[model samples]
Target: MALWIYRRLPGAGAAPRPVHLAHRIGGAVLLVLSLPIAYHCITAYGVQMDSARVALHSLAGCFFYGAFAAKVLIVRSRHLPGWALPLAGGTLVTLIAILWSSAALWQLAQP
Candidate 1:
């Protein structure tokens, strides 16, 4: 996927490309880093969903989505390949999950 993105981009034609092995390893690392945070978000504050908590969660969600957007833009501008489709799909799923969970939490937090 990353390769596809890299191939399609323009400026990325000259950028120092990370080796495939390194890319996979880096992806694994990112997955590892995200797991605990996801677990905590779902298990801990997920149940409460109060306005305050939802506000914070929304902020975090914004950050996550924003970063994804920024990364996509950077890769696109650099004419580099990336795991575009999968990353986009994953981001969509994450957004939906968070929004749904937040709604539930908000209901729970309501008087």
Candidate 2:
């Protein structure tokens, strides 16, 4: 996120090829590392909406992948508007934050 923001800054100039490479590598690593957690969540509890918090977490979890797909598509497309990739990336990040707060933090707060 910080790298994306830095790249977006007005005076930051064009990001070097290595920076873009690093960003892609980081995203791939995050996706690979998240698979086990996603599998556990889906197999263990499925999509429970028994409470508001659970519902938010479940919905965000579901949307995160869709957003990821969109971002990947945006990255690969040649004709998309300039803002499209950033918008997709931002949405994914927001969903991650929501999921972390709604699920992980909630679990940590349990007695």
Candidate 3:
């Protein structure tokens, strides 16, 4: 749906934009906020057994990830500056690493 909207919108399909430094910084902040919540959810896994808490944290993390992806798209569209791409990529990679590590730890802790 979002891809369709972007394609339909004027100027959105033209070219890949670079991400701005500020936008990259914002993405980093979002990634930081999401990491802890994601870690908590992963660490808890089946141990906590609190569906509500897990759901809320997962939703929040999803929102943060969505924002991060949007920033990446904006950067890719050349709307942002070129220098920030590395930062954006680093932030995304770190988020994935943290999520994976936390999940692995959680699994090890279980049973």
1 or 2: which has the higher lDDT? 2
Candidate 1 wrong stretches, greater than 4 Å: 1-5, 14-18, 52-111
Q: Write the per-residue lDDT of candidate 1 for residues 2-82, one digit (tens) a residue.
A: 544446556556334455557657756865687686677767655443577577565655556565566546544645454
Q: After superposition, how far is residue 76 of candidate 2 from its true place, in Å?
A: 1.0
Q: After aligning candidate 1 to the native by TM-score, how far in Å is the CA of 11 from where it should be?
A: 4.5
The model with the greatest lDDT is 2
For all predicted structures, in order, the TM-scores are 0.39, 0.86, 0.37
lDDT of 3: 0.56
lDDT of 3 by residue, 60-89 (tens): 455447647765685558666755655665
Error of 1 at 16 (Å): 8.8
Tens digit of per-residue lDDT, candidate 2, span 1-111: 445445666677777777777888989999999989999999999999899999999889889999998999988999999888779978998999999999779899999
Worst 10 residues of 1 by lDDT: 12-21
Candidate lDDT (C-alpha), each: 0.60, 0.87, 0.56
**How many clashing residue pairs are found in candidate 2?**
0
